[model samples]
Target chain A: MQRYFVNADPSAEITLPSEAAHHLLKVMRAGIGTKVELVLADHCVYLATVSVTEPAAKLKIIQKLLSNSELPVSVTLACGIPKTKEKPELIVQKSTELGADKIVFFEAARSISHWQGSKQKRKIERLQKIAESAAEQSHRNKIPLVEYCKSLDALISDYPATKRVVAWEESAKQGETSALAHQFNGLQAGDSMLAVFGPEGGLTETEITKMNNAGIEAVGLGPRILRTETAPLYFMAAISYAMELS
Target chain B: MQRYFVNADPSAEITLPSEAAHHLLKVMRAGIGTKVELVLADHCVYLATVSVTEPAAKLKIIQKLLSNSELPVSVTLACGIPKTKEKPELIVQKSTELGADKIVFFEAARSISHWQGSKQKRKIERLQKIAESAAEQSHRNKIPLVEYCKSLDALISDYPATKRVVAWEESAKQGETSALAHQFNGLQAGDSMLAVFGPEGGLTETEITKMNNAGIEAVGLGPRILRTETAPLYFMAAISYAMELS
Candidate 1:
């Protein structure tokens, strides 16, 4: 059954948002008695059926299903804003499928394109939509949030987690293989992690120093040099494998 | 320094391939004395400097660099050919960066598109170019090959490995978590792994049964539905984490 995220409390009947209702009614051709999964305000999946569709799409909740498809430790991926438009979109879509809790694009020292004023809001809205669709497709119970950070300092200050690490290319170059796994080992259930990544030219030395001072350990993904966009997805998969699968 | 894969043997002087020469000379504006890393026939990274730019670009080998960016265990991704043209391209490029040794596209029962005759050759050629470029970008010593398997049976027969597994969604739905880690644990260094994935509609029950009978274990990536392209990349990153980083 197709899944849609709604913000209503657990009740006998709930009305879906306009976008989701349109998707269910026209796009998916869902009619009366059509079954679907609704992730309501509590971030829980509920079995639902189309009860009414004339005024608006109202779903009648049958029973709450025991579905939890999130990572044990919440992962917030703070990436340095990449040069191209497609890189952020790719990062958001793929990382959502890989089970990211939050995706934040921060302006780095070498960032070419800057999202300012109206552009920032518009970009976030578009990326948020991508995340919602990806989460539904991946059967995730919760949709990951997409946001923007002003700078490295602001990102670090705002999103403090139990564990903070940076995916530094120099760390991989130096063959520091154990740092990432060590961070993974240190985490317990319900702990959140903040992983930082750089843009095309990579993080500057000053930025690295600042992050290091802020207690963010620099770690490497592997020996190969992953592009600005590929590193975060690699981090997400590795964490899932370590914490969830292993 | 830019890296290029060449078919030449390690020597004092070697001529660059036409494509590499054009990229080095025109695109990058590299001239005499420009440094480049060349992965020659021996699959070793050699530090070379441009010796001539006339007629055809030539480079003089300085010394072999001690660089090995591949995973300890070889990974061969056998994917059921995806529908759109971009998915295969994305898979090849990203998987190459993540350290895949070889990538094969096979025709699955549920596969929508079929690569036939001249079209097959052309598609493989285009994807191979993508792999080569991605390898260079990722600083991989070996360029992963892109090939087409006529069918799943052909893929199984041609590529025999120490371990063979398939990324099955039903396995995840059934809550089979440890199967993938178990497979990874059984692998030793220098061992080769063949991981198969389904296309959009996913592998049919009959196809899964055949693989099971052939002793290919079905492993779940996680409790999520990965798209045709995302599944292989997840498998690649997981293997890299288990075998290389961890």
Candidate 2:
């Protein structure tokens, strides 16, 4: 069954947006009396039956399905803006599927690409759309939000979590085995975590110092050097391992 | 420093091949006295100095670098062949970076795309290249091999390991907890493990039953549904967490 996210409270009937209507009506060829899973404002999955169609799509609510696929911990991924256009998009799409709560792209010291003016909004909108689709495909309870931060400092200041950590390559080089797991083990349910990652050239000393000052512990993913896009996914998976698997 | 894999035994002096020579000279712009790390046939990391510049790239042994970046327990990822060309390539590349010992792509019941006569060779070659590049970039001690298995039976019969597990969606749907960690706890060093994953549409009940008959345990990754590419990565990170971090 196809799924769509609608920003409305759990009610009797709901209508999908134009894009989702097209996808359900044309792409999926859903007709009258078609059953689909719909997520409303309460972030709950409900079984809905198609009532009306054509230009606009309307659905009548059946019984709500008791589904819970959200991560126990709210994970916010703060990544340094990578050089390529595709890296952030890929990161957002994959992380959304992997159960990221939020994703923030911050401008780092060594970041080559900068989003300014209308480019920032357009890029974030495209990434947000990708996240929405990925969330539906993964059957996530909530769609991960995609946003941009002005700088590393602004990111730290804006999103303050219960636990904050940075994925430091130097930690892996120094053979710090238990830092990441230790950080993850300290997290509890409903406790938010903010994990920072570097770009292509990696985070500089000054950036690390600032984050350290803000009480963010530097942690290692593993011994191998993951690329800018790969590190966040690794972190996300490791988080899932700690909270969900273990 | 750049890293290269050389298929030579431990010796005093070694000359790089023509392809490596061109990559060092033209691509990396290595001078006569440039230092680079090489993983020889012994699978040991050794630092070497460029000795000769003419004809071919030659290097003299300086000293061995104490770099053991591999996972403690070997991980073999048996993935169902994905639909797109980019997916397998991405899987190989990312899994190599995450410390996979080997990657096997098997033809699954849900697989929509098939690797035909010459396309199989081309696809394997491309994925192999991706694995090699990812290995070098991640500073891995050994390059993970990319292989193909004709069927699930071939996969089960050929790849024998100490522990065999499958990432089953139904297990996750049943809210099973810590199946991967439970398997990881029983593993020892030098004990290889094989983890199976499904394609986009996912594994059928009959295929799961076949694996079960062959002593393959079905394990859930997490609560959320993971994409075909993301499942293996979650397995890799979970293994790393169990062996290296915890």
Q: What's the count of clashing pairs in each model shown?
A: 0, 0
- Whole-model lDDT, candidate 2? 0.91
Number of the top candidate by lDDT? 1
Residue B164, model 1: lDDT of 98
Error (Å) of candidate 2 at residue A29 is 1.0
Point out the worst 10-residue segment of candidate 2 chain A by lDDT.
Answer: A7-16
- A1-246, model 1: which lDDT tens digit per residue? 799998889964699889899998999998999999999999999999999998998889989899999999899999999999999999999999999999999999999999999999999999999999999999998899999999998998899999999999999999888999999999999999999999999999999999999999999899999999999999999999999899
Consecutive 10-residue window with the lowest summed lDDT within model 1 chain A = A7-16
For candidate 2, write residues A1-246 as lDDT tens digits: 788999988854688999999999999999999999999999999999999996589988988999988889999999999999989989999999889999999999999999888999999999999999999999988999999999987998899999999999998888898988888888899999999999999999999999999999999888999999999999888888888887
lDDT of 2 by residue, B25-129 (tens): 899999888999999998999999899989778999889888889998888999999999888988999999999999999999999988868998998998888
TM-score of each: 0.99, 0.98
RMSD of each: 0.9, 1.0
* Model 1 agreement with the true structure over B170-212: per-residue lDDT tens digits: 9999999999999999999989999999999999999999999
